[model samples]
Target chain A: MEITPTRVNFEFNPHVPIIMDSGIFKAIKSGGSSREQAIKSMYEDNKFRTQLSKYIAQNQGNEEDTKDIFQEALIILDKNLRNGKVDEDQNINAYLFKTCKLLWLNSLRKNNKIQLIDFEENPEELVTNEDLETFREEGKYKSLQKALTKLNDRCREILVLWSQSYSMKEIMKKLDLKSEAMARKSKHQCLLKLMQIIKSDPNGWED
Target chain B: MNESFYTELLEIKAQGKLNPEQEALLTSLIPQGSDLSSELKAYHLAKQAIEIDISNELKFKFNEWDQKKKSRLFRVDFKTISIAASLFLFLSVCSILWHSNQHFSNRRIVNDHLHKFNTEIRGVNSGPETLSDRIGKLRDGLEQNPTLVIQETQALLKLSVTGVQKDAIEWTLALAYLENNQNEKALTLLKSINANPDHSYQKHSKAVLDKLNSNWRVFLF
Candidate 1:
């Protein structure tokens, strides 16, 4: 099945430059309702999807890869544009494709795949402050997700409940434990177990 | 340092229940310029990951796109009436013709732009040789000394910025990637040039991209 943007909630007027003059970039940068609108707009844009699909296909990446690449690229572009890294006269569409290409290519390189199309090299170490932060968060998230997956169901539940701010008394009541001490011990033990798992995995996180 | 005290500190931190006295103690215990306790940091990270579900959202969007594509395929394949199919075929033919025309025009424009760009850049007076000079040299050495060129290009590219110099360096780096058999990176760079009409070396870059893509098609198909 080929991916296409078949559903558009509103007409996208190409004549109107939405990247700069409009508040879409600002909204994306601010993140919230405006960001959601920008994401939806990007998802609905036929050209944007096509560019992603084409590049992904050409690079031996799948549709899922396209989705991640597209989102990350948009985030970087949003941040860069806000910081004036992208010139005002530059075409936003071009910037999108360019950034997507670099990210996807970098992913391929990281995976140790030699297969790449030589369009041009990404000079100037394209990683941004936002990208570094995102990478750190991604690493931490992956490590944590892995550790959580390895835990017993009860331990996972206990830790999750504690993280969500349940007091020992509340947790004991909710989980039908014997006492507050029991809930506290269980939560503490669960945290220890999670930490152990994360620490054991050398590749779990990177600064 | 008491290990149990550290453990208790982490436990309270994870639960967001650290009192002012406990927080002060934690601040005192933790070495300056060091991160928060490792266990506590891990716990918090995992907890945030679970609560925010940022990774999960990525998966959700991918699934949505996949399902939409499948449904579209099913609809077009099984439910399209003969009249609609005929119209579709007609539109397809029209699209192909129009696309071919645009391709030829784009090629001409790219060639013209490259000629002008080359002329303009060549007119810039030569300055003292530096890292940019090495990038230029690597560009020339890409076919001759691919490994060394790639090494130099990567080093130089890391230090370059966005401008005519960086653009030229990127162009060379792309060539280095191609020479080093990293076709994916090369293709990506070429695609950027092809897509951006206002790129510094837009014409020459796109021309190279077109050639490479054509070769790729032959190689793949």
Candidate 2:
């Protein structure tokens, strides 16, 4: 006797758990085109900029200062997101405002216009100390990127690809190398060269 | 393991592509006290740092937007500056007009005091050769022939006369000096008359002195 197979239909439920990769955190994790879209959307959104500008203006800052602080805050935010220092559910606007406020305060401190202890009191509970540490790490990354530019095109290409997590086999095929060993050796030599360059200019990595 | 072998393992480990056996092998090869651990850490940091890519296109977009905002602000600043300049000019013009009117009014008061003195001289009538007649002659020639009035007033003052006649002769001499452009002599005579409390021309002299002293422009016109 032949048996007929029954069709099992599953209805969509609103309460069911769905993984949505729509937020800035997920976009940054995805990198490439998605990361660009996320950054563009965040930049074009006037709410964050307006709030940040208002905060900076109230704290002895001008329009130009606001622009600088906002741009820097956006870059730091992007870096922190990419580094997994920011939580997925964190409010991007609030995070940006706090970052801008801290950056401006830091600038004021650097200029001797404010005491460090004065702005440190009652720090926002939303931005943890770890998040602030990421800002400093972001500076180091900037210096590293600057050092990366001094290398030859071939070295930069290999190092960039390696840094992007391309396997040895993939890197060798992409760069038309003879073998994985050659790719590894080239990557190691390029890194060593990069380190040498960084060592030559000790002050370059101080940031 | 050799340097290249360990570096390959470390790179794989950084990429999170190492299997359990490879991870164990890397851990066993590079002990915690080994210098390769620091190398691995540095390699990881460099990888993470270089992965942060901020596109130049985004930076260019932001700079373009900033330039547009700055140009807008500059346009607003120029308009504000123009309005402020216009206001400053208007206030300056008004101030000048007000000062000119004040100077003109002061000059008119001085002229009125001189006219009152002339009218008083004309009102007084004694017969010919009297102090009143001599003062009348001085007043008549005060405008055109002040030199003759000065000479005659000096002659009249040398004679002993009544208090009223003395006051009239001194007043006429002062006016003659003023008409002859001898303002120092005129001011001296007027100050003397103003210092005398019982003199009949004391109040008129004080008024003319006040007007003359109020503004130097009064003397120019």
The residue-level lDDT of candidate 1 at A29 comes to 49
User: Which residue pairs in candidate 2 have backbone atoms (N, alpha carbon, C) closer than 3 angstroms, thus clashing?
Assistant: none
Q: For candidate 2, what is the DockQ-based docking class?
A: incorrect
DockQ of each: 0.09, 0.15
Taking the tens digit of each residue's C-alpha lDDT, what string does model 1 give over A92-194? 6655666776676667656756444334444653443334234345666666677778889788777655543456787798789999878777776676666
Q: Rate residue A96 of model 2 by lDDT.
A: 67
Off by over 4 Å in 2: A1-22, A116-124, A128-150, A157-207, B1-23, B27-34, B44-61, B64-221
What does candidate 1's lDDT look like per residue over B50-75, in tens digits?
A: 44343355446646866887899887
DockQ, computed on Cα atoms, for candidate 2: 0.15
Candidate with best DockQ:
2
> Where's the lowest-lDDT run of ten residues in candidate 1 chain B?
B105-114
What would the per-residue lDDT of candidate 2 be over residues A99-136, giving only the tens digit for each residue?
77767766765565544432334555555545554325
